[model samples]
Target: MPMDRRSVLKGASGIAAASTLSGCLGFLGGGGGGGNQGDAMLWHAMTESETETFEESLSIYNDENDAEIVAEENGDLRNNVETTLPTGDGPEMYRWAQDWAGNHYQRDFLYDASDDIDFNLEDTFSQAAVQAITVGADDAVVGLPVGGETVTLLYNKDMVDSPPETYAEMESTMEEYHDPSNGQYGLSHPIDAYFVSAWMHAFGGYYFQVNEDGEGVTGLDLDETKRGMEFVRDSIWPYVPADTNPGPQQAIFQNGSAPFAVNGPWSIATFEDNGINVGVTSFPTVDGNTPSPYTGTSMWYFTTRMADDEDRRESALDYAKWISQSEERQRAYADAHSDVPVLNSISAEDLGDQVAGFKGSYEGGIAMPNHPKMGSVWTPTEDAMNAVLQDDADIDSRFDEAAETVRSNWEE
Candidate 1:
């Protein structure tokens, strides 16, 4: 999949808030040491509610631990962090992207958590998330997975009324469910790069073409992506109706104007808040296999700016690992934020009934592009998909165009 933030950026609130809380709770600042024990100051970019949640967790930690962690919500804490690392003013604890984690490792921004962290990796979390955060080209420890949002099928219950049992049924029912005469579309997703890569993935086409040897190399799959694009462009978007597609999809779903919509979990809160009965499932089936949502990894990173003292650095890594690798923490995350906890202990078995229906979808999730060029692929790709969605281009040809855009923009 391409590197646009939207595909990976679904479920916006949870990760950002969790990072801020964890960063602040573990933060140590000033001399990077406390009085006697030395004080640890953490500056984090967390929503006010999230900041409060972290403070409560800290209250629990303080009751047991000796180190005092002082934290505050820094409105621009994420941006302020880089500035601090160079001047050594950054928080001792913070959460950042894997790419940022890699860069900071070269700069010596973070510490190693191998020995000091409490969580047992063999028992906690997915292998992919752990591997992505901890291993890099140099095998240097970089960051931890604070949380992630997987792309899943988001449909308006009002439109479908009853969820479709199979792909054919789903499509057949769309005609009945959709009401263009009422100015409602069957579904709506932005016609931009972030949204397009996923629409492609659901169709079984990938950005990186595999050589005959089976090693991942570079080639465009545009030639093979037509069926999926046509289904969306000619079948789905037209039913959504012109002008009724609305501005951003969140608005459409919130107002119940769009009978069908597909986005990510971050929008879960809005749906629940708006009192919309939402149905979430695996991305969708095509070509005999259920499609996967593009999974993006978010992690806790250490920076070069922290004190070179191995002991303090170890503590920082411990903090990151604790949050990233703990089932207890992930469960707490789900309870506070509506997330599918990503640990072995908190499996589909542990999610209970509310999440049981959607757990299968999480298993089908796919990792988004890790290439440095991924961030740049979104715009053109979205434009290409929009061509299909807008009825401005042929569906078969439009997806091929999107694939070309992905290839042109991909770094690999």
Candidate 2:
């Protein structure tokens, strides 16, 4: 994956020519053509804004080859892959994050892509992005990188000439700037499942523990992660109002109602367009080490539903390798938007001098846990994390309780 994951979240301001991308060969819209269709490949992805991206990308890929390709916005692949695959109705390729790669690979539902695909992991992607996706004891290759996105801190320059460099400075700045009486909030921190884990890890806490052997892993390392949760609980509230939830507050932050907001580079344009002079920084360090904001990478994976069907698999494999390795294509893709390209050759021109400490995120960020058990912990974790943020209980005690729940839920 590319060095900066933060870029993907940015709106498509600088993206390369969408028309040129539509020229790619074999990308289709719907999934139903027969085997006779020249190298037709189907793709399944989420209904995210990014999904349209892959659809547009397919038009480009189809232009490259005399083949029929289709990309369907299938939403959550986790729940649908089963029925779709067994019926041979699954897409030839599916968009998935690295976290979900392992469990499916272990279930024998995913293809061992390494055999047919020549992925220059060393050359095509950054080393850290590679590690973030790999799994199992052997860490076999299960898929190819579609894109990589990172987390970055965004601040309003008008509020503070210089944004805080450390956690202490940030908190103090928020306190000084907060003016709830006039309806101004210093920060817009959200307490939801998708984001809670992100902030928690960035602050140096995590949900699970994996041993050196990589076999014994546990849930919610409260012992180590509690500090992160507490930090979130204590530092963000006074500056925020009760009614402002994630989506609305994010709007507030963009509109200048909040001076400080924690978000990825994807949200940069929103802040910029609203006349907010913006600055980007890495997530601040806590103790000796900076908290690890989680990383999420998108990839193309083939399903075993067509395991015995060699022709489509070969076509799918060929297409996957080509786009992934096309430095020109990847560059164009990034030029269209900021999501970090998997191709290592991509330039940092889009980011330039605005973002500091980005390389740190590209290097340090770890993928969200992909293990099956991961889905189960979000509810309890969010509840506990939310409780702490509202100051309902002692941070120490609340985190301790969350940790116990996480540990009990861990399967592997």
Candidate 3:
């Protein structure tokens, strides 16, 4: 975690050289041998336009460094990376979320790129970005940070003159705008743990703690977490629909039936395409505390298989450093994907207003626990939230039950 929310929304951008690779990296094709010279493969899950952006970015790197880089999109990316790495047959590099770093590192499948990459983290990227890739007690750098995202308050500017500054104000907006009978709502968000984490942090709660040993200690703050749950059950539930998921929540807001929503930047393009005059900002303060959404990052992970081949590892690290450290490339990516860059060199003036707010949300946000134990949290939390919304039990008791479920899963 970096500074409290106030500091993070402040700024961050990368560079593409003007060259192209001679050959293509097979899309979803089988992994190939280590690079004989400057050639290497990068496997990722990006689609359509995203794939084009990635290829273009790498092409810049390839042109600048005389590297032959093959970039490919794999629908089965995660499964392939997990199953193939141990056999020393995975791509030299792969793209994955920051949270996946811990599980993959634990499996002894990831390469430590601390000594390989050329940039100084403190000077180049946000503290959160640096922390996202660092692993173990030694704090080795496991990945090179790229695109980042966090949930924020997305509101219709046409419906309200400005975004709400506090939860109380937001509630007042809900009171004024929520007309269920008229198919309109002031606010609507998915009722999953992913979205609810913002509320949890607003109430000063968290999922787990990581020790100096890089080990996780389950630290689900029961009391504060329950307070968060109570707010959702007693307060927000009344204004929202009986049931809501991502699609319906986005639909409600995009169709003008909802004036506000909590969503990630990924939805911004869709909202714009539908002609919604959307405005974004950090989630309003709750109980005088900043709302902390779960920060997510897309990063480049070097594999043990790549590290085994000295030439390939060197080429991979060079490319990763170029993509991550180049300020111009980072800015280009931000423009192409509507993503917020993690590099500090990009400057605040470059990101514009709405993106700065999302960056601010990331600043005030908490990193999702990378530990495998986090796998146990989502289902139990979702079940508890659903039960409370359906009036299945008292809020406190339901939350207590959910905490127990999380602990049980961790123990198992």
Candidate 4:
């Protein structure tokens, strides 16, 4: 029997906990055939709930069509794909974040779906979802986006009667609830680049900006970037715990010590499991400017394994089209996993409040740059954030150093 939404939802917490423990393990090997195989295989690292919903959708598709597609859940999908695809041993397709679209396309590892796929990409998916998988000149589509996610302000309903609407109000609430002696905090927020992207965007700064030539230009040394970092250091960091790791930050919120947390949809199931009445909303405005978090899509990327084989390519594309175009299948994924569906037909009202809240957040977010050079920006930015938030280093100097590091890394 196919798994239902309730069963998937019930197993979410255990799946999340297991994933945390197995995150570092790589693919164990012994999967089906690769490039020459007639059947289409998909490698993914989806959680238990997402896998169940996806398999149910696939089962329906397989029954109605001649194409036979299989999903292999790997703990280290990204690494495995990167290492195996070049040798022609990778699966026909893989499900991953759209940010890898640029890198994979550049490496000649992706199949351009725009050339052969019949679906109307722009009309079927949201604008941001389409943009996430578009790479190189003339906007070549390297993948089909299924769902999206972004960070939002999640508050405990018992502690906060209404979610804060502005940074000033959030700061005041943080001050009121902060008690270092009791190991309590007003808010739990990670200081990494991914989490801090919202703050940078609110201050008119960005880690990287695509230029007129479609190349990414580093923005680490921008005055606005420094201002955003300073704002966090001065106004927000005071009430937050010194440990900026996501695990500890989430633990604070999960245990009910922190009333507010800036997290993604992946965190909702765990929070709910912990018995917190969580409410999701867009981040509070900063000086009349809304914070735009980095929005990312979970997409199905076709690999070169199917590129030269006409039959395999057709079968893989058929599966992609079937999965992406079906509103019922997409809605099932949203219901089971709290994802913001990319399908235009699935309105926010169709899903529950949790998905609606994330939809609002995703709509207001900045599509994360998929440029390959973006890989060079994270480490240096994290170093800068750690310096400013943890060690009280000078923001300007730290960012200046970070900018130089990014430039050097790109050059290398």
Best by TM-score: 4
User: Which 10 consecutive positions of candidate 2 have the poorest summed lDDT?
Assistant: 19-28
lDDT of 1 by residue, 83-105 (tens): 66666555666643453443445
For candidate 2, write residues 120-139 as lDDT tens digits: 67766877567655666776
- Candidate 1: what lDDT? 0.52
**Native-referenced Cα lDDT, model 4:** 0.77
**C-alpha lDDT score of every prediction, in listed order:** 0.52, 0.59, 0.70, 0.77
- Tens-digit per-residue lDDT, 1-412, candidate 3: 1111211111100001111100111112343333333377788766455677777888777787777977766666667777777776768888866767777887887888777666578888887788788877777788888867777888988887888899889888888989989888777676666677788766766656576776665545368777877777777777777774555555678688787888766666667766889898888887788878788777888788666778777777878887887777777766765567888866557786767777888877887666656666666677777877885677677767777877786677
Distance from true location, Cα of 345 in model 1, Å: 0.8
Write one digit per residue (lDDT tens) for candidate 4, span 123-161: 888878988878887788787878887778889999998
For every model shown, the clashing-pair count is 20, 42, 9, 0
Q: Each candidate: RMSD to true structure?
A: 5.9, 6.3, 7.2, 5.5
lDDT of 2 at 280: 65
TM-score of each: 0.76, 0.80, 0.88, 0.90
Pairs that clash in candidate 3: 9-360, 13-346, 14-326, 14-327, 14-328, 14-329, 14-330, 15-326, 15-329
Report residue 137 deviation for candidate 4 (angstroms).
Answer: 2.2
